[model samples]
Target: MRDADPDLFVAVAHACLLGESPFWHPRERALYWCDIPGHRLQRFEPAGGALAHWDFDTDVASCAPQLDGRLLLAMRDGLWRFDPASGERRLAAKPPYDPAKERFNDGKCDPQGRFWVGTIYEPRDAAAATLHCLTREGLKRKAGGVTVANGLAWSPDGATMYWTDTKAHTIYAFDFEPHAGELSRQRVFAQFAPRAEGQPLDDYGGRPDGAAVDTEGCYWVAMFEGQRVLRLSPAGEVLREVLLPVRCATMPCFGGDDLKTLYITTAREKRPAAELAAQALAGCVLGLRVDVPGLPVNVVHV
Candidate 1:
């Protein structure tokens, strides 16, 4: 059953082609997100409902806040630091894979300040993607053999890491060592039935896209094509299911002065015309108030 809440509403007016990787800046009290297909980075200040965006020549897949107020962005070409005040970007690392066939997708900073990012293998024929960890030491491939790497998050205690492969309809968890940013004993955390070729939309539980963890250690994940977000318990049990008004919910992050607002980003790129017509707000950012506050945004140290 859907948890109907009056607090849910569209937080941004503009629609994006593919909105992903929403990060709530704690100090700025603002929300930052990426429109990958649109090649833009967006910011929203709820205090005045002001919206700002920066256009990029390449796809900006994900970003994380840095201690120096700059943004660490994972783009099609490489890892970069973007200065919003001056509109300048400095390359930190180049693409580890063939930029033509693979690009960075979902990413976030671990508790120890390392930026962990995963790739999307565009071929869609094989598991050719990999996840990498970036630190001052350099980029290291942490895991591999995946197609669409999404749903990256950590447990509240930072002892477990969660990651998902959207095309496979699987979420994986790993025992984590925060200090070294190491993942071990990776196992299936959750799995959904594959969306059949002629499957009805209402009959399918969407594949995992992007995710976040709350203070209670529950994992909240957006379901692409499922039109909902699922809050899962630590043991992989469903706690709450939030039915969204749109079809392609891409990701969810917690924001607000108290970190109780669940902000979700959706997608419209490549969707059928009939589907888009049915869901007018398919690509807009949506929000709702929640009782549990979320874990604080992890600032990237480097």
Candidate 2:
């Protein structure tokens, strides 16, 4: 991977987060993400570099802006409707597998306003979680099995649902019937070749964590252990590489007024003292200016 231009990126937040799930709220002109292990939600307004954070009693894996001005949150155990303005958190529903040692991971809403999330085992159970769909009518549908589901996105036309299993290091495409929230035709869309370093292998294969899809249908995915965010074409060809200062960069989101700035979240979990020393900005939030503007993110409907 080529080194990113330092001038294009400046560290915005000095947060020591196991950061994931970066989302842009256009109305508020802010970026939202989570420190998963830290059990907190953070809101960063980049224009002036001011940030506000909320600590949750439990680990929050992801969040989405709601049309009603609330936020849809996926906590470790269940779904929650969080009114950040009022600081109220009401349980929406719990998935069937919300037993101890399980938690939601990465997720996002569809263009039609339906929310989708996936789960994972707290201690790294390879096959413990599944994907689910949350509809407007208070229905949760079991979408499919995913071992450590991380990145979730939708195609430009809403006809395709793209999801990733971080451990598998592969992105899969499904035929999504948006009106009914039905998924079919599962096919492998992209796979990560192992890095030059010899790391232990796993059942699902690669390590693709959080991701975002641009307006041109390219996927910018954070390869956690790979130490970089890779921009790949819809056809799974590597187009560009955005290297991180740390080895554990978790997710990327496009924000800023013009939507051309790419904001990334990093993590500091499980690093050795030497590694952490080499990458002091391990969990710091990083930003960049890409050439293209991102597609508008969809807000969840309450």
Candidate 3:
């Protein structure tokens, strides 16, 4: 139940346009995240304070590690196989939708090594976005009716899956068959009060963004523009609220040797100049120490 210290140090570059989809690489002992609008992938080594970035031609929304030390990237153009060592990348699968109207957003590798990626319908008019699973057969649509798809996670036992529609201010749970990589019995897991028209920033609790699950099966999710992260129990009760120093927290991941180090990625894209100036850590990757350890990052079997 500890909140991130207000004075937390920046874990990476202090100015990512829109940081999202952070994950802990157990093998590298580091943290990786995407700067979606910036078209970049970031890697930070906490132990040595080292930082590395790979620029991309399109928006790289999320990434998952592979067994061979390569990365599976969910970019606007397609699913990509990227070799970090050699900086060589190739298209694995083409985008399922038009890249101009929809692009991949939040994503993660399922426990069974399938890459599950969601999309964002940019026009903000309808529920056109959907979640897709990348398996040996190809990209298959798993869920739909989301405008800004995000907050993907799974339970420790691998029996339940979680997803979010940030535009709808709702989080959903599904019966998951881990071995088969299937989802069923979708239902609302949590819902927050939507921001009223003309609501001030301080009055809004924020919509769900990206999330991760702990070893205890609790879900930890970032509330974008809410200035906090909420840890929810399996039944969807809010267990803890960890306040953040910035307003737009996009995602969080657990790192460090014991997986107790919580890393948060924030956003600055299109934020007011006055607000960004006031919040020095507006787009920086922030870190804090948490009490509970998280589940290890799953590798995609490429």
Candidate 4:
């Protein structure tokens, strides 16, 4: 028998381009995310219907809640500690240059209190990027070659890690020794077709953008150009499929009072006017109610 149809949960308007990196702040009862192309960070509180945004001078790739209640941000310049309350920013790391061709992309904090960030090549370049782990001790360890590094999440027990390279249409898993910041036995955990199985992909090279893990150890991944977020078991079996009004869904995170609401972000990058008009919600924030709640947001060990 086929699964039941997924429903439209929330149709948020006025989202910026390349919406990504959804993080939940439980204390504030808010959901935070970024728009890469618009260089902005946004927060939404479903409880009060409050929406606030911050525009940065550079692309904000991802963000995590710091132990002290501020935010640790991964921007185009590298890593920074941002005080959303006071509007102050402190640089944590500087990107190595090839000025016109390289920039920071997606990242997330692991359970071990370290941040793993990756870079991406400009549209015209073919050079691969790398993922690096940053520790509170001020040491950065190169985890080696990655291209178009995008989604990131850790398993429920902190014993496995997942990361993606959008250009590759592949999600990889590692035997994660979280307490030590070590990875082993990299293998394919999931993959996507160039299209939504039967439909033509709205963008080139259908791949994953961002992903999240639930308390049940299942994964929810956003499919850029595929117009859906796919939930899969740890063995990589599809559990559910959520259709989005927009094709370029970038990421998903769990938020709300019980962390059972799934919040998603999308992108409008590289689309023409006609496509943009057809997909007005393309870069908007989307939400849905699910039976499963997500794991707690990992705190940055400062």
Which one is best on TM-score? 1
Candidate 1 structure quality by residue, lDDT tens digits, 1-302: 24434567999868999999998998998999999989999999999989999999999999999989999999999999999999999998999999999999999999989999999999989999999999898999999878999999999989999999999999999999887888899999999889899988877889999999999999999989988999999999999988888889999999998999999999999999988997899889999899999998899996
Question: Which stretches of model 4 miss by more than 4 angstroms?
Answer: 1-6, 97-99, 123-127, 195-199, 202-205
Candidate 3: misplaced stretches above 4 Å? Answer: 1-9
Pairs of residues clashing in candidate 3: none
Error of 4 at 216 (Å): 1.4
Q: How much is 65 displaced in model 1, in angstroms?
A: 0.3
Best by lDDT: 1
lDDT order, best first, reads 1, 3, 4, 2
Candidate 2 per-residue C-alpha lDDT over 1-302 given as tens digits, one digit per residue, 9 for 90 to 100: 33544644654546655988889899999989888889898898877788888898888899998889999889876889999888999888775574576788897988988888888765675666688878867747555566788778887778888888776677888898877788899999898765545654222123688888888888888888666788989888989877667777788889988889888898888877877887777888888888887777888874
Model 3 over residues 81-167: C-alpha lDDT tens digits?
999899999888999999889999998998888899999999989999999999898899998999999999989999999999999
lDDT scores of the candidates, listed in order: 0.93, 0.80, 0.90, 0.81
Q: Estimate each model's TM-score.
A: 0.98, 0.92, 0.97, 0.92
Error of 4 at 150 (Å): 1.3
Q: How well is each residue in 1-302 modelled by candidate 4, as lDDT tens digits?
A: 22223566554576677888888898988888888878898988777788899889988988998888889888887788999988999998877545367777788889878888877877625537778787866646555466688778999999998988787788989999867788899999988765554554544435788899999999999888777789989998999888777767888998888988888888888877877897777777888988999987888885
Which ten contiguous residues of candidate 1 have the minimum total lDDT?
1-10
